[model samples]
Target: MSWNKLLCNLRELQLSGTLNGGQSFRWEYNKEMDEWTGVFSKTVWKLRQREEFLQYKVIGSLLQSIVQKKNDVEFDNNGVFEGLLKKYFRLDFNLSDYYTKWSEKDDLFKAACKQFYGIRMLAQEPVENLFSFICSQNNHISRISSMVEKLCKHYGEEICEQDGVTYYSFPDVEKLSTPKVESELRQLGFGYRAKFIQKSAAQILEWEGEKWFAGLQDMKYKEARLELMKLCGIGPKVADCICLMSLNHLEALPVDTHVYQIAAQNYLPHLRGKKNVTEKMYSEIGDHFRSLYGDYAGWAHTVLFCADLKKFQQTTDSEDIKPKKRRKKT
Candidate 1:
């Protein structure tokens, strides 16, 4: 249960309420307080996620939140530590099989998969996830994250400050389900996504809407994803992201530009030439990965996605690539 030696690179994990599909966050540790506080946990739950192995420090509030939430359960470092370890590292799907198959060709990809992509699981919060993905359509990460932050700051409650940083809690249904708020968000630069987020929030706040979302909880993976797609700003890819990350549907595949690139060069070469990517093609590509890697389709997606990102960064002329210096033994 003691995780003093377990996790490292705490920023990689998406403890934030919104899943932007990009692993970029803003959290700084307070050495004096010895507590990690931010909008989300911002604690790296997976230890083997990075090339360098470092000691994992326990954040007091995050552990306390879990303990306090559980009825009749007392707060103990051991119990809290164990709960987090299980939550992050314990995979319902097998990784060994996926890793072995992926590692066959490129050793670099294998290492990238195991180290970076493997641990970066999506934590999807239904409403927030829905809006985040909506914000992501035909948009960039920097812009998407900024828009999300704007919405949260404008609409969400100001929880408290930690180390001079003000962290805004995610807005609830009540605050977001109004026409006035939706209009304000549009003015704040959400553009098309603002309308969808506002309408979706309004629907979720409705009486019948609760039942609709509740029903999705017990539905099958495909059914649940399909149901989510009914909401405004919910497309096939967006719905799949919500299902896999937030709804606990492990096999869900959310295709985007990066995944499309992988499908072209790596997976399906013939489909690469298509000018427009259709639903049938996307489903076929998902099936291909599922068939080849079996249950680790999501895992493979993460691996390939991260590998593609790294390759893209390396090849881009805008960014400078420098050699990584080796750390000397302590």
Candidate 2:
């Protein structure tokens, strides 16, 4: 099958890091194929990158039927899926320009950008983003991902299957709001988050239905965050996460331990050696980044957060080290 291409720079859209990073947890990389497959925006996508293009394949019965019929599908001609990809990836944003601006303003960001370019924030679905972060409370990426997959498998509608693997769309609020959902999720290893997921879904449905999330997009950053906090399991951090990731609030910075450490080490010296991040400290850290990075402080924070991750530590260690000189002895 022929692949469709979106003209993209590697420095602006590194698929490996962006897809598998903590923002969204659905993508799986195939080492042999040098590609990634993930379910998002209600469809499965297989993506890879060449020098200056992001190559993609839409994998599903409906899309594949159209592709087989057309033989060579041009995204320009078929706008729906293409548009979804563009919006989901926030393709309209010029990340390179932001990188330059951020690098000029902050030395730490400039340094981190050296190894962590192309870590753009994904505009994920709010429902998916909400539950995923609920699972993220005191959880690692691997486990959060596992719980998310279970949520889809058990409650979500099956979208399609490929190569013996089935893809499921994230469950809708109604589907997740069942009376038995909490118990079922507990049995499926969701732990305490089971109640959060179920109750939040129910609350959302009761308040204004599924469209409530769309309404959040139209709200100011603070307003949207306050609204999200009204739901079960959503606190300041998770609310900020949903706002930045889904509700079009780029300025919303979610301060977890990772972000707090980043701030203490490079920006806020007084925060160093603090045993816990108090509510006052959290607001202070967020305000500091907002002042430094402006409207897209959350976006900027994501880059530094990715740079600080242990998986990427090897690059930081090797690249940042300077070789010793021995020629003086000779």
Candidate 3:
């Protein structure tokens, strides 16, 4: 397979913000080389953005960790790679127009947009979104990424080997459904999430495979979430994530702990009077965004969420003054 290079306006597309912005977390950034290596669509590749010009190398066939002379497949200056990148990043959509419109809607959203300006929601694969969110329960971004990478390396087919390092694709649903897969994940420190991953895969298999997950894209947001809830470990939050990121449910708002705080501070200030937000409060927050931001509510909520995460990074990380309560994910 050949890969193509896409050079675009830096203001509209920034790899540091979009890739490192923390939506889908499979890409591994090599600081020394200034490159990011990751697998998507079952192909392993390397990319580096030089100002406006995006350079790439398609080191094909994930099944081989060690590559000889002939086995190496390369992609360059072709429609195949260009189409893939366009579809992956949703480049057809003009994000600047969205930013302008969203900023006009609310002052808070306006402020958040200013901070993480070029961040765009990625259209992740359904299987990857399903299992990745499964691993995300009771976990943070960094660990969630590690667990996802481990799942790929263990069950996925190897793509290629570079500098003694091998990259693999995300494991297939059938490959992940067996009893042994859950056991392997347990040993890999998946903890309680191991059960969720295996059980979810089993449920998908019972539904007659990929079409079950594919059909989700055609359904309404509430309906899709209900169907997703049938799988183990998928709650309102995770369901919303799968919907918004991959299933084209742009209005879905994943009310995680961070969003809960933002709601308490800004939109739902009545939440301050209570110890924790109830189900009613969660619905209120999601509904609030749905009403305010309209169609692209999910996209707006994502930038705000990332902005909130960035805010926490600048805060002091000491717990000496007072005891902290573990706020459950709403």
Candidate 4:
């Protein structure tokens, strides 16, 4: 298959950080090929980065015909795919501009930018983002990813098979809302999250059907977050996550334990030594970031969050120390 190109800079968007950085859990990296394969918008995609552009290939069948009709666009297949990719990665928003503004206001963000550039927030589909985060409570990324994969394998429709591995689209609300889904998910090792997934799906269907999430984009941030919290197992944090990631509420920040630590150490020292983040503390942390970074506080929080991750820390440490050791030897 021919690789299609999207003009993108490495400094503006890094696939390594954005794809696997706990936002969405579907992407799998192939070390040898240096590419990522994932499913979204009912299509499987393989993507890699070149110096000045992103190279991508459609792996299997696509459901973009509906998208084309909705947008009333007569573009070719590649054009439609390109539009989807742009929307998914949110390429319209200039990350460099945000980085400049963030760095100017906060010294920590300025420091984080040294080693953590190109961490863009993904504009994920609301249905996928909702359930994926429902699985994230008190869990790590690796396990959350496994559970999400199982959901697709069991409930989602098969898109295609590549290299002896099958890929499935994330199941729609109707599919997940069936009476038996909860029990089946528990058997699949979803544990307590199984109920959340099934109940949330059923709630979506009952409240406003599949198109309900689209309505959230038109609401204010606080209003949208409250609407999400009305679902089972969705708390303030998960609600904020869905709001920022899928609902286009850029100011919404999800204050989890990791985020709380970051806030305590740098932004809110008064929160230091606090064992748990209370509801009030959560508001404080998020509000501080919003005050600091303004509209795109969640996006800024992601950059700092990525910088604090052990994976990125190890990479930064290696790069920083290797050259210094070489210099000393020389």
Candidate 5:
């Protein structure tokens, strides 16, 4: 209901490179309006990039907690949203500093910095991150986004209906834990991933909710990964993604097909001869990037990953990137 403008430079925080880089899903780009509309946490937000600043509007808000408090314009407090935007965008982490440090070390990262400079890692909600990555197996960005959106639309709480757009909250674990939910997911075109999401949700509930997942946040990376692996359908890559994107384990590198090919083609040519990225190679690749990129290896890897994706397919918008180019089916 409230229209607002955030003054971050378009260069310092480009939505095209940052949000579209495939971290979180559900945002939709309106080409005509030049705006991106999406829900994150319980808020339905629309953002558009202008030359000097980004204009945003809180189109709708969802009810969170037992209070049933809605963040609509009638009760709108810009301070609450100000905090959310700052945290979501991770403004505390200076992009210019990262660019300077990374570009100085490696030419590839230097080149990556120039293209995807403002591509900061989003601080996603951990529960949503867990469920979202489960849907990512053998999936493209668009499919994953669609699956997540379907999950919200069907199971997630209905926040509001505005201008024919209905906003729903990401479904709670209780909503997704049932076998019925799994069956419904298949009907929704989730295919086998429906089971993965259903089982993963149940496992978290079995672990007695966020306490266990939050525990991983404090764990060492190896232990953190092993802990995540215990969940059904979670593997090294998925666990690593959860760790890096949500759990604050910046060194976690989720090696997928794209990373493997890029490494072989550019960084490690010996990998070119290998038919597949074996377990050993995966660890080696992760370790190599860690050695190369240091503490924020995962973030650096993502920048390179997005750069590679942008290179192969001229993806100026996040919607344009797809998983067909992903090395999974190959």
Candidate 6:
């Protein structure tokens, strides 16, 4: 159960994306085991336990694998955190300008960031982020997390144990592609999303190795997102979530209902009367934010969303704390 040494600033990983309390696709630390575990579908993947640089054991190799498999939904040892942080967060970028712009217009956004005590952002596995967001469509956070957890526990490989807790490895495409296995996910409360997961898994599994990797390579970020959308259950927003969280494409704008509301209220007041926001509209919005904020648009969005949620919770708390006036005698 003893890890070599913990990273002092480890919470930075959680800031890579917006994850509400008890949400399906967020990582949480296990205090007893001194490990960071991501729980999706009731299966836990030990993402990072100790400082890998300090402990040059299999843990370092494992961390690299999980981060490298960035855009692929299955959790593996594909990520290299030290390089990722240096390239992404610690380097020079206009964090102040974006924060100011977001704070100037949106009180909610400002409040949420302040409330969370400046958790940086969450960097999610590309494939899992993609599939998670797809499952999120017309769904609640609790249900989505539950479904993903089930998928991992049922199909993924058991990787390691820390303390008394065992972690499971995320399934690869081959394991998830089978219809017989995917159907069982419905029994775990995936409901209609079971078919989408199965079909997408099959579609990816059918691709030739180089062909699949090649498809992910393209200069235009939009192109990469579009390629993902061709699969079942992957819409524009879901694709963008994959791009931003997994592929490290920082400008990708994922407009869920929360984001849409935030945008409409803060930046685009005139976007009223549109039955459904179009891809073109999303593009324009994304481009404007990118131009205004530069490389960290996705991060900015995540921070703002988290800030908004915090504000909402604060308001609720304040109302609850207010005393009711005594009723006058009739």
- Against the correct fold, how does model 5 do in TM-score? 0.91
TM-score on alpha carbons, each prediction = 0.72, 0.89, 0.87, 0.91, 0.91, 0.68
Tens digit per residue, CA lDDT, model 3, 1-330: 333568766656666666755467677677677777777877777777776667777776542333333456653334565667777777878988988988898899898877677777788889998898888777666677789999999989877787898888899999889989888899999999999999999899999877987788888888998899899888888888889888888898887666788888998787766666677877899999889889889888878876766644411221220111111235
Residue 286 in candidate 3, Cα distance off native in Å: 0.7
- CA lDDT of each prediction against the hidden true structure: 0.57, 0.80, 0.76, 0.83, 0.80, 0.55
- Per residue, candidate 5 scores C-alpha lDDT tens digits across 25-72 of 877777777778888878888888887777787766653332234433
Pairs with backbone N, CA or C atoms under 3 Å apart (clashes), candidate 3: 2-75, 3-75, 3-76, 62-158, 62-159, 63-158
- Per-residue CA lDDT of model 2 for 127-215, tens digit only, reads 89888888878766567778899999988878888889888888888999988999999999889899999999999999876578888
Model 3 spans > 4 angstroms off: 1-4, 62-77, 312-329
Q: How close is candidate 2 to the true structure, as a TM-score?
A: 0.89
Clashes of 4: 0
Clash pairs, model 1 backbone: 10-44
What ranges in model 4 sit over 4 Å off?
Answer: 64-75, 310-330
**What tens digits encode model 4's per-residue C-alpha lDDT throughout 1-330?**
999999999898898778756788788777778888889988999999988999999998547566667879764778878998999999999989889999999999999888888998999999989988888777755677788889888888898999999999998888899889999999988898889889999999998865688788899999999999899999898899899999999999988777888889887888899887888998899899999999999999888877777343332222321211111000
Instruction: Give the C-alpha miss distance for residue 271 in model 2, angstroms.
Output: 1.0
Q: Return the lDDT, model 2, position 110.
A: 95
In model 1, which range of ten residues has the least summed lDDT?
321-330
lDDT for 176 in candidate 6 is 72
Candidate 1 per-residue C-alpha lDDT over 54-129 given as tens digits, one digit per residue, 9 for 90 to 100 = 3344433333654567855666665566555545434333545556676774564566655453345644445566
The most accurate candidate by lDDT is 4
Candidate 6, residues 127-155, lDDT tens digits: the string is 56656665666665445555666666687
Model 1 scores a TM of 0.72
